[model samples]
Target: MPRGFWKGLLKVLAFFAVIGGIAIAVLRVWFVDVVTVRHNGMAPTMILGDRVLVWRDARLERDDIALCRHPQDDPARWVIGRVAVMPGGEIAAERGQLRLGRDRVTHDVRGQVRFTDGETRHTFTMSWGTEEFDDYEEHLFFDRADRPFALRAMTRINGLYLLGDNRAHLGEDSRTFGPVQASGCRGEVFMRLTAAEGGLPDEIPHGALDILD
Candidate 1:
């Protein structure tokens, strides 16, 4: 090949590289980002190890799945949940059904075991107000001592009330740690990059991709 041919090829490669770098910078700054689910709290909706795309400026609404900084854990760590209650809304859990104002949102489960944190397993029959497991039941129930089935006032304010899709997962949402501040939300999960049949990679088939609803 001639010297001119080599020079032209090098210039083209450099130009494409520059464009790719700019595109990555824009995505990191203002567009979208990818995050891996770290827990099974949002199971059925989002399993553990699922890769999801989060839109930074997406408008949040009730029932939207989102990623937020844990209210009681390290600020840098993230937790994913559904927006059960938005700002300017009153939220409480009566029995196991979630009540936003007068409307009650009940999960669809008929005595199914949703999750197990340890030796203790949680079922849909056990309401959020009831203490089923002798160990850690007090921590899982959100109601205050005075109000048996109602959430504390700390969770009803200028923030969002998030709940795990898997209602049986204890100590995994506003029910345990309180509501997350609006500012603490990282972004709303709008897409799923990769999917698996189970929470682990071993359970995923050779080629399976599922889009989140």
Candidate 2:
């Protein structure tokens, strides 16, 4: 091979190596998972045709956005919602809802909440509350009327419950399925890259902050 041609080829190889390294680093930082917006399930919070990134192994905090997978024996699917409740915590949904734990409290849809010490209260939106609780219970096998689906506690270390603010009116969610396991969670969402037009109010600032473990 010509001396000049050999040098040029080496430079090309070096450039590709650098590009490959960058790609790997990006993937490691931002765990990529493709989630399909099934229905108006998380509407007003998340819309259809929206693809998101979940920062795997990111520092989790109150009100952090997340992309979660469905529970076992069900469809292999994904849903996007905020971290309503995390591990070692108890979150109640409806008044008569039945959860494993006993501590129950009444909370208005848009009411301000107080968290445990060292925790901050994030202004979360109830994009949609249960529209037809009666309808849902009438057909539920466990007699939802007497026992509302309650994910009262998280026994596991990384348990998380994600719910659509648009409650009953929406489709599948913890209300329908149950609390999502930590293993099912894909990652945390730090930024909404393309579909930034319609999203939750400015209650929580919107930006891409470096995800810390």
Candidate 3:
């Protein structure tokens, strides 16, 4: 190649590199959150090893998936789950039923989720049901006819109430700890990632390729 052609190519590459670096900096500092699913607390909804993209400062409402600080004040730790109640709203459970402000979060049984855990090879049978809250509705996984743990009853005090979709892991979220401070939340998990082909077993619900909720 001629010297002029080489020089032009170098300049173009430098310009692109500068632009790319700036974009990445903005994303990491203010917008992007790449979260790895570390536990099966959100089983059937999200499984272990899933990579998720959480957008910072996104407005979170009931039924939205949230990424927040762990209740134990571990700066290195993060907790992700569905928002059961927004700030200042009451969330509770009666017997085995979920409720918010004395209203039941009711839904019809959609189907049964049957999937094998990729890590433990354990098979789970969870009742997939649509839970309604005000004008919004979401599908969630819960214990079947044979309950492993009863849903504990309590009312929300303050902050954001978050809970895992997998009721079998009922103690994994806000139910075990108190509500998470809304201001401390990192963001909303809007996207879930998957491999194009067979590097690992696929475990996400309905084989969803993207968008967790």
Candidate 4:
């Protein structure tokens, strides 16, 4: 080919490269990010060492797992939980269950899972099960067969009501903190990236990636 033809091809390639770079930058800044699961707060759903993809600036709704910064202890740390109660509803939680206005959130028994906490220095087994709220449900672990779910007071959230899947004392979430502002919640954790070596708990097996519920 002529010199001019080669020059034109190179320019086109450069232009496309610049555009691709810009798109990735925008995605990283305001659209998507990856966060490692440091806590068993999400338990069987998302365990420690689980690298998850967060969709930044997500339009959150009930049952959506919100990714937000830790309000009290560390500003740098990211916290995640399910949007159990929406902003509009009259939030009231009692007897291991949550009541949003008239609708009562119920837990439908759906077997159980036993997994050890890879994040903690102390190793122990945690049993979890799927809890249902009408038709919609999530994998929320209350406790062992002997222990009942602990009750929590409703702290009115103008933005979002976040709750961890593992409702244990160890789970640091809105249970430990109060309700969080929706604006402060960065995004929603929609997918778990493929587990690396020692990336997940031994109990929960996954393939390339996990499309979260």
| Best prediction by TM-score | 3
Query: Against the true structure, what is every candidate's RMSD?
Result: 10.1, 13.1, 5.1, 5.7
Order the candidate numbers by TM-score, best to worst.
Answer: 3, 4, 1, 2
Question: In lDDT terms, how accurate is model 4?
Answer: 0.70
Q: By TM-score, is 1 or 2 better? A: 1
Off by over 4 Å in 4: 1-30, 121-127, 134-142, 169-171, 196-207
Question: Clashes in each model (backbone N, CA, C under 3 Å)?
Answer: 0, 6, 0, 0
Deviation in angstroms for 33 in model 2? 3.7
**Could you tell me the lDDT of residue 156 within candidate 3?**
43
* Candidate models: Cα lDDT each: 0.62, 0.47, 0.73, 0.70
Q: What is the lDDT, from 0 to 100, of the residue 11 in candidate 4?
A: 100
Residue lDDT tens for model 4, 1-213: 999999999999999999999986887787789888777777667776778889988998888888987777677777889887777545666665666666776665544544445665444445555677754556645455555565555544665667777766354776677677887888899888755444334445554478776
Q: Model 3, 12-35: lDDT tens per residue?
A: 999999999999688878898777
TM accuracy, model 4? 0.73
Model 1 ranges off by over 4 Å: 1-29, 106-156, 197-209
TM-score of each: 0.62, 0.48, 0.75, 0.73
